[model samples]
Target: MEVNPLNIFFVKSDSKGDRLLFRYPYTTENKDESKQKKYGRHNPYAINSTEDLLQNPQSQTSNICKGQLSGFTDEMLSTLFAVKAELCNRKFELKVNDVRFVGHPTLLPYRTNKDDTATMILINIVFALQASASHSVVKCYYDLSKRLGKALRHEEKRCSYLTEEMKIMLAAHDEVSVLDSEMNGDNDDDDDNLRHSVSSATYSSENGADSSPKSAFHLILQRSSLARSMKSVFEELSSTGIVQVRINKWVLLSFCLPHKAHQIHNRGLIIEPETIDKCLQKLRPYHGILLMVNPNELLASIPLDSSSALLRLIKLYSPLKSLQTLAIEADLTLKQVSQLTGHLVYWAKATVIYPLCESNVYVVAPGANVHINSPLVEEFAKEFPGLCLLQ
Candidate 1:
């Protein structure tokens, strides 16, 4: 997904007329005339979902337009426009190119989530919606979705955007987990260990009743260098062939192949094609309806040169798919699609369902997708750590 900065404008009116002056801090030019022709005035970067339009009417305009936009609080909005008008009156440079001025989005609605994990997940979704570029938001969402899956231990709903149902589910899941732990006589250490092992980030103690999750998310986001962090994670995985996982953080960085496991340390664990099939059998009841996993993450991997062809293929068969079926739908030889799935299946990168080691088939967990609770999945997570589930 792309992360383009939106434009900002100052609207001024005198007795004679009204004038609109603008500045764009984050703008990208499409060098290819043909590509530009494809989108024209319509910026294809933004996804115009109904949820988006309802929340913010100004979102109807392209990010290139600079009057008013979403993702800003009322105070920030007033202050920014005031600054723009002042700058215009003084004939100073009216265009500000920095992201520093952009404030956090509205927080009250999303803070309804019961805990920090759910709250953070919701904030990330709002950020994705308000973010400028598509790819960057995609990356952000991809990582957040993984965190959500781990935190809630659910596969049916990964992306917890403005959806109220997900919030309720997450709260309920938390309650049930607590109840189960208490009933099972699990101690605080056990709970802490489980949370520590899976969480992406440690919850800050400073989050009081008055404090906002939206603000907390923005703080972490601002402090974070996501692109650099992503690059480092990618490089570390590529070079060392070792994936270190610390949940609640964006970079769990898990990736390993079946053959590669031997190079590291052997747990005497061997996953055959049949083992994968059995796992699929277990997961079939829940998530087998889909052909492919998360297409956004899969499509994120395709290079710009091959993206069009890959995207065409993805559109044709981007659903719950087995390797053989996808090959037929994509009109590609089985060998080609198999190779594609192999690259994508790493560390649950683009998947909602667990993938067989180096296979094109995928399956969602019956409840939480973690391997620790299930004998089969626990075996996988133990072996792979941060990547594919063991079961």
Candidate 2:
């Protein structure tokens, strides 16, 4: 099953006064001050912009019960519980400073010590669940436009830096998505991240809703915001725990694609048989690409673009082909090959020949062609015979 990217926020209460400092970029939009003061009996404070959490981190005496937290819907809690249960069942071992899954080095300061905060709790949850699960990991996707609008009012320079960081993050995610499709051939079909406003709101409702006594007094968040990046969120969460720390040294580098990338990182149109035929008809006037389809030989059609070296690579493609093998055949780096394959699979709607075994020597087709007597592969071969299959 596919899991949507997880968004977790940690807020610390102000030690100095009744006001709370938002460790995360909490939203103040769609909130009416006067009406809230009249109906809710209190005026909502503007989101705190201070970066230093130590100045006023939440303490035991802090009044966090006064609607400081929100967005804890039943669905979200159920998912979190399910994740936790799975980790326990698997007996997955995790430590507070475990940095195996996290890409950024300096983004995490708990490597040497521990901090008693919601940030540590959520991080452990995300990391342990990811380690235990086979097909999901937590991800953060931000909407730059909305974030800039909110940040511009408070800090211009910080907003500018954030913009650049987001660009790099998006690019990195896209790259990972492409690589995942090529390697795993898994189809991720959920679009939970891009749906709706994706914002969590704070609400104070009646008592009978939760099992915990504190639930009635605690603030409830409905959803998460797209205004802050994962890095930003983590930084703020650790603000109180770590002192005088600068996250400038942390930089995200290219890494192995996660299991969730295949579904979320799709591009190009999935062509139907009729559409394939129409594309073939358009290509009838050309002679460079040849089309041949045969199932008896256990080989699909040979639809090779006559002029493209990349197409030639696919025609003779095998996952077993080493870097040396590729180099001997064509002057292409691994990155170049990966980029080309990404275009072919995602943009061209090519079939991926997934490995059926651990050694990757045995291979099988997609679920649509799982059964031996299934006609899907033959029909697929007939439509566009020379299309490349990812292995």
**Top-lDDT structure, candidate number:** 1
Model 1 clash count equals: 28
Stretches > 4 Å off in candidate 1: 1-293, 307-309, 318-322, 350-391
Question: Model 2 compared with the native: what TM-score?
Answer: 0.25
Task: List, residue by residue over 1-391, the lDDT tens digit for candidate 1.
Answer: 1222233222222222332211212122321343357545786697875655546554233322343333433234334333322222121122233221221211112223357343322111111123332332334333432442333222223433333433333343343344334433464686665754343132233333422122222233233333223333334433433334432243243434332222233233333334434544443312212333446655674445554535755666534455565567677875565444443433233332432345565566455445456575756667578866542
The superposed Cα distance between candidate 2 and the true structure at residue 357, in angstroms, equals 19
For model 1, give the 10-residue run with minimal summed lDDT: 120-129
Residue by residue across 309-345, what tens digits does model 2's lDDT show? 5655555555445433544466665555544444443
- Evaluate residue 167 in candidate 2 and report its C-alpha lDDT on the 0 to 100 scale: 36
Give the alpha-carbon lDDT of every model.
0.36, 0.30
- Model 1: how far is 249 from its true place, Å? 26
RMSD of each: 24.3, 21.5
CA shift at 206, candidate 2, in angstroms? 31
